[model samples]
Target: MILDSDTTKVISILGNDYTIKAPEGQEQALMDAVTMLKSALSETKRSYPTLIGDRLLVLAALNLCSKQVELQRQHAEELSRYEEQVSATVEVIEKTIAQG
Candidate 1:
């Protein structure tokens, strides 16, 4: 099935047709990526792609790793801020406690 007004190429995987809109002349690249992903997913002897299959696992792992790196950076920043706040609060609290 093809959509008339979409710039995206239609790719069929796991019996479902997905229309992806890519930049001009990038359809082939998209197709190539899909092919690679599908081939990776085909190890289970099924024509259709499985979400829980090995290929999917690898893809998910790659994506998760990328996200994890980003999250770690953000977490480090947050931790720095929190530590500064705690240090300031401790300094104030220590002065008050000593005064008492």
Candidate 2:
């Protein structure tokens, strides 16, 4: 599935315009992500007023990346725990069936 450049939406971040294309049904999600990134950049700029351009963007990107990594780690741990519980449940069911 290929999206044409004409279908791209323009978003502004720190006064710069960016054109982004998303899957047919995910335009809203893409806009939502742009909003989140703009918010993050704005917050970072407020906290460090002296930073500009590349430095500001890099810091914001790093902050977002760190949060994303942490969330993924937590999700992985939760999935592991869920899998363990399911496995124990299956083992108990198998044992019960063997004993019947």
Candidate 3:
């Protein structure tokens, strides 16, 4: 889990170069997520140019959190449907075996 010097990369985001050190297998995915966040921040900057860096980051994080909540809700609904289907199938199997 030690991401040392050689594993760090300088990524440019919102006109700043940030040196990010990610573990060996996670660098690309981490960079991609950063890139997407930067894009969201850039859009926020375009709409509110007077906002400070910290404010922009906060807004971006809020937006990301909202999306995560929405996704979790959807996943929960799907899981519930799957569980219902599994329960119905199990009941049918038990009934059929009892008759056999």
* TM agreement with the true structure for every prediction: 0.39, 0.88, 0.81
**Candidate 3 ranges beyond 4 A from true positions:** 1-6
lDDT by residue (tens digit), candidate 1, 3-97: 55536678887677888897777777888888766665564335335455455656654665676899999999999999999999999999999
Question: In terms of TM-score, how similar is model 3 to the real structure?
Answer: 0.81
Q: Rank the candidates by TM-score, best first.
A: 2, 3, 1
lDDT of 3 at 19: 92
Candidate 1 lDDT score at position 2: 68
Considering lDDT, where higher is better, how would the candidates rank from best to worst?
A: 2, 3, 1
Per-residue lDDT value at 94 in model 1? 100
The residue-by-residue lDDT of candidate 2 on 1-100, one tens digit each, is: 9746335788888778988777778888998898888888998999999999989999999999999999999999999999999999999999999999
Candidate 3 at 82: error in angstroms? 0.8
Question: Pick by TM-score: which candidate is best?
Answer: 2
> Residue 95 error for model 2, in Å?
0.8
lDDT of 3 by residue, 1-100 (tens): 9636447888876578889887878888988898789888987788789987788889877888888999999999999999999999999999999999
Off by more than 4 A, model 1: 1-6, 44-100
RMSD of each: 10.0, 2.6, 3.1
Clash counts for all predictions: 2, 0, 0
C-alpha displacement of 82 in model 2, angstroms? 0.5
